[model samples]
Target: MRQGSNFLWFLRAAVGAAILLGAVLLTACGSVEDVDLTPACPTGVGRGIWDPGSLEGKDAGPEVRKLLESPRFGATPQAVRDLERGIVDQRLIAALRTLTQEHRICVRAFKEGHYFLPGVEDGPRIPEGYGKAGGLPNTHYYGRAADVWWVDGKPVEGNATDQDVMEIGEILAGIPSGRRPDQIIGPPRWARDLGYGNQRGWILAPDQLELHRDHIHIGYVNGEATNETR
Candidate 1:
């Protein structure tokens, strides 16, 4: 009886020690849920006050034109065609240009579809039972969103575990509030790692995560800037 009790105790101790060691390893390796990578805003560039006037314009402004012509940024053929025909907000153009130039990252923009028109066939048709009911229409419809599927010659899909992709997502998330997009969606693991687990606009829900796994969606409010920062 004494020998049997000693054996049982040893077995329990071994199991407990193994479980503790596994937890330690997970923490040391910086598991997604356990890691927090809230990045610091650049010097003198903390979240700036939004200038409502910045988004008020009927046509693509000079800055928007310049950014579209910039070599730092690239776009899909469909995106180029749609962008030329559609009017994109200037603030979004500025943000994308800055993202590409500063990071030396190749940003390939893609269009979602035509903006929602009253009677156009190919124009904004939200599938029934899709997304949060009563949610706002797709930002792309307002030319306030851009989808990036490729970065620096690498496809964003199937590369969620890549450090480079995570770093880029982090940079986008870290942009000062009012300057960054209102909705930034990327890989599920990296999104959580960047402290966007419970963020209002950042992707966290399972449905959103699945839809955005292939691309990074940067969306802005039509006339106002979002108020979220690292």
Candidate 2:
């Protein structure tokens, strides 16, 4: 509640405008203040714990302002925010965040009351066989699937040598495989794996994840993968 004072003030401002003569108006024009730059990622390239503005000096947009104004979507939702992208389809983002929260995953960006690691993940790279299933099984082209080395932004260094990825993967298995489809290639061998990454070989490195070697591919909001048939 006290962490973000700027939004707190706007919360009481009432939509930045007033309504009159059947016309709605805000108190002032909408503008985004410049956000702070970090050494790890100067351009705000990586994902943040919460929204971009929550960082040291990022501009809080109208969406953030509206969220602040609404007392209902406070504290709870903010506590689990991890991926904060400036996308027009906010509903989809909100849905993903909600799903994460429902699974008890503590997201950095969604959560307002907590302090989180500044950088979650650097950016997902495009894996091979995008938009089309590769020569391997369970591999397909759809914006919905991705071979992420990291989840929610943080990399899970594994599959080759980084034991961290395994630890993270174990935790990530918390979400339903059908929904997350995070790795979608090679998950853990012994443990309960996700639905998409149920293929053979390559147990834990983002590199050996078939279609993904150096960089993983993240699909768009409405992407679909052709598994089993491929």
lDDT of 2 at 177: 33
lDDT per residue as tens, model 1, 101-182: 5443333343444322334423233433444422445666667778776665466788876776777776676667677776
Off by over 4 Å in 2: 1-143, 146-159, 186-211, 215-230
lDDT of 1 at 177: 63
Best by lDDT: 1
lDDT of 2: 0.32
Q: Which candidate number maximizes TM-score? A: 1
lDDT of 2 by residue, 1-230 (tens): 67688788877576544434114222242322322122111123322333434533544345544533332222233222322223212332332343333221112222123211133221223223332432332211221222333333333333323343344344344433334433333333323333333332113444345334322322222333312121
Candidate 2 TM-score versus the reference: 0.30
Please report how far candidate 2 places residue 22 from its true position, in Å.
52
RMSD of each: 18.2, 16.2
Give the alpha-carbon lDDT of every model.
Answer: 0.59, 0.32
Model 1 CA lDDT for position 101: 58
